[model samples]
Target: MIKHSIRVTPNRKGIWFIVNRGRIWLSAKRELPQGTYNELILSAEPEQFCLIGQLGDQDAYLLVNHDHIANEDEWVTPRELLTVSEETFQLAARAVQVALFLQTHRFCGQCGSAMSLVSWELAALCNKCGHRCYPRIAPCVLVGIVKDNQILLARSNRHRAGFFSILAGFVESGETLEQAAVREVKEEVGIDIANLRYVGSQPWPFPHSLMTGFIADYVAGDIVCQPHEIEEAYWFSFDQLPETPLEQTLSGQIIAQLKQISGNKKAT
Candidate 1:
């Protein structure tokens, strides 16, 4: 089990995830610092110490250091760890999200009182009005609408030309994953989808986002891009697709799966 907001000593030894601002401190090799707390030799005193989880036999901890550890090789965002081992990436994600949660949730939202960490849990309690807050995780849906050998790819307004990916949007307050998929597809590309197949999930910690992926069959509607939302969207053949998301991303995985399924059908 993972421990949060725990006390630790400078002599404590383990893997360290020293985070500052939104980036994490790393060695020159772009790897997390490991060893005893003092051996890590942090430039600034950490605002907090959290035992995120266990990495193998060693305990993994996050040092919330808000100071800007100067130099480019000193820090990198969690995105840099995408190509690393899944276990390492997960630990890095947890570290950053927990740090961000602690940094932002210092003050109570409802009562405007200083919040203190609960001794035995990952939450902050506002003693003034009994308000409690946990780390916020925004749930997002990734819909890969497939129609035979083609997959629908879209370039959002935020993306530049040539790059495209599957449709994605945040889940609404009272909607299922399937509902969110259908709604996001329709609103983003004016398409209808069905036969939603659950794929997998990935923790994307750009300030804490959980991406749930799905593969749905295209049902109807034309590709009419939403103004100021989607730049361009079209059904691209698996054989001849333009630039898309990397294989490390969910959209990329979905596209690759569609292509693989198509290849299998042809072989059969």
Candidate 2:
């Protein structure tokens, strides 16, 4: 479905680039412009570059340590990229992930040997010790617990004031996604949950994380916020909920879903 190639063609308009230090260099309009790699006037050729993938009819490339090319172009961070079109955002996210992978995989961890990119795949190969490494995608679980017309939300100590979100944690080794969901919920809020139904998944590219979402019904236990983790935890009625995450995130999506389900139930 998705086409990817290593070939670079000259005379094309300009290439979309994920440039230095995990930022995207694009037109000043904050959009993907029509262009080719040949049109870019760089101070020097990029030391590291990879053809990430074809976005629509254009090829996007990820370049490391790129020199500033034009005054009309602006560099945007990954978070700012999310405000653009969904297609552009997804492309930029993928480019960032690839760039980060290349940056950290230059040397083999096991043999201390220099590693080279494998031509046919997205991986690093250590010729000396025959070690190969691929981009890491950490799996995380996000769970929304619903009880009647009220939903459980928590404020993490790390978040800014007034921001609340559902329970979430990274999946540890040798644990199932369901197990992680339950454990995270209990450990973070001191509550028990059951009927963890798979809701959805999102590719969160803050250095490559795959968030798997789940919705669970509250079974038992009173709220006991974990120190240094959850600053506050409470069950808020649907109409009286506090400030939550943006709808673009999995946590916000799950919360919206819960609201819709509750509304329908009340209507019927």
- Highest-scoring model, lDDT: 1
TM-score (C-alpha, index-matched) for candidate 2: 0.90
Displacement of residue 111 (Cα, Å) in model 2 is 0.9
Q: lDDT for every model?
A: 0.87, 0.80
Per-residue lDDT tens digits of candidate 1, residues 1-268? 4576456777888999988887888887767888888787666788888788988899999889877477857788887887887788888889999999999989999989999988788999999999999889999999888887788999998888999899999999999988999999999989889999999998988679999999999998889999999999988888899998878877789889988998899899
What CA root-mean-square deviation does each model show from the true structure? 1.4, 2.6
Q: Provide the global lDDT of candidate 2 against the true structure.
A: 0.80
For model 2, how does the per-residue alpha-carbon lDDT over 1-268 read when each residue is reduced to its tens digit? Answer: 2223355456644356646667777665666556666766556767676766666766666666556656524777666666555566666777777778888999999999999988878889999999999889999999999998889999999988888899999999999999999999989988899999999997777669888999999999999998888999889898888899877777889999999999999999
| After superposition, candidate 2 runs with Cα above 4 Å error | 1-9, 12-15, 66-73
